[model samples]
Target: MPVKYNVTERKNLQDPQAAPKFYASAKADGEVNLKSLSKEIAGGSTTVSDTDVLAVLNDLIKVVSRHLADGKIVKLGDFGNFQVSISSDGAETAAKVTSSLIRNNKINFRPGADLRDMLSTLKYEKYSR
Candidate 1:
């Protein structure tokens, strides 16, 4: 199954008056939740059951969260690296900056080589609504 996408028009934020640019927006066929993913894993001739897979996946989430909270980066082998990033308001002086100045906190994911390589050979088809 090829990835599907639809043409979308987006306005350039830097130049609102400029002509809208066209881009390809991913058209999701459906989302595979943990249950579905676990079932797929169990479909293989492996001893691991879906329940055990789910438990491990759940623990992975918890472990990643704890590490990120501790100001540590979590590297999931070739999958990617996860880390916490912050957006803070600029202060006039370095001494005036404080934790309170931090406005937004987010998790950033950087795809690894395998994922990047997959994208380089990605196949897509136009999807109609």
Candidate 2:
């Protein structure tokens, strides 16, 4: 199936006098949850149950979360890499920094080679509202 995108006009908030620019935004056809994904993977093998796939997937999530919390970069082979990132206010001096200076924390995912190549291989279709 071809991925769908729509042309959107976005204004530059930083420059009010600038002309609006056009960009291609992906038009989502639908959302697939973990249950649906497990079912799809199980379809190829008649012996594997969806429940088994789901159980393994659940364990994967837990393992990833635990390792990431421990400040370890989790690499899922060709799938991707997951790590933690933090944003904090700058300190006047190295000794002045404290826990209160820390502002935000987030998990960052970097796609592996196979996932990154999908952008060039996938077909696209223009979507109109």
Candidate 3:
């Protein structure tokens, strides 16, 4: 069986009649319901269950919270740093300075060399007239 994935497209907010834009604008400002958003993305009449989406988002939040509590920097592959810092007294001055205040019992994940190399190899395609 082939794997299926969801692809999203960006819509222009400047056009009010642009196939029901996802976000609200001054012309038609209203609350954005998840069901409507899901339906639009699903590209079908099938209704999306809220539980599934909520579960995935909750899991992600839990993972990030756990890592933060452990004083460990959660490094996403090819992404930036997610570490906690604090203010500390500087040696040169008597005033406190903001710096990386890594606490005890922390785990930090430095991106692997392969990940860095892959990120650095990104190239954009040129548009032809």
Instruction: Flag regions of model 3 displaced more than 4 Å.
Output: 1-50, 78-80, 90-129
How many residue-pair clashes does candidate 2 contain? 0
The TM-score obtained by model 3 is 0.33
lDDT for model 3 comes to 0.54
Displacement of residue 110 (Cα, Å) in model 2 is: 1.0
Worst 10 residues of 2 by lDDT: 120-129
Residue lDDT tens for model 2, 1-129: 999999999999999999999999999999999999999999988999999999999999999999999999999999999999988999989999998998999999999999999977999999966
* Stretches > 4 Å off in candidate 2: none
> Candidate 2 — which pairs collide?
none
Off by over 4 Å in 1: none
Give the per-residue lDDT of model 3 (tens digit) for 69-113: 777778766654567654444465534433443233333445667
Report, for every candidate in turn, its global Cα lDDT versus the true structure. 0.93, 0.95, 0.54
What's the TM for model 1?
A: 0.90
Q: What TM-score fits each model?
A: 0.90, 0.90, 0.33
* Number of the candidate with higher lDDT, 2 or 3: 2
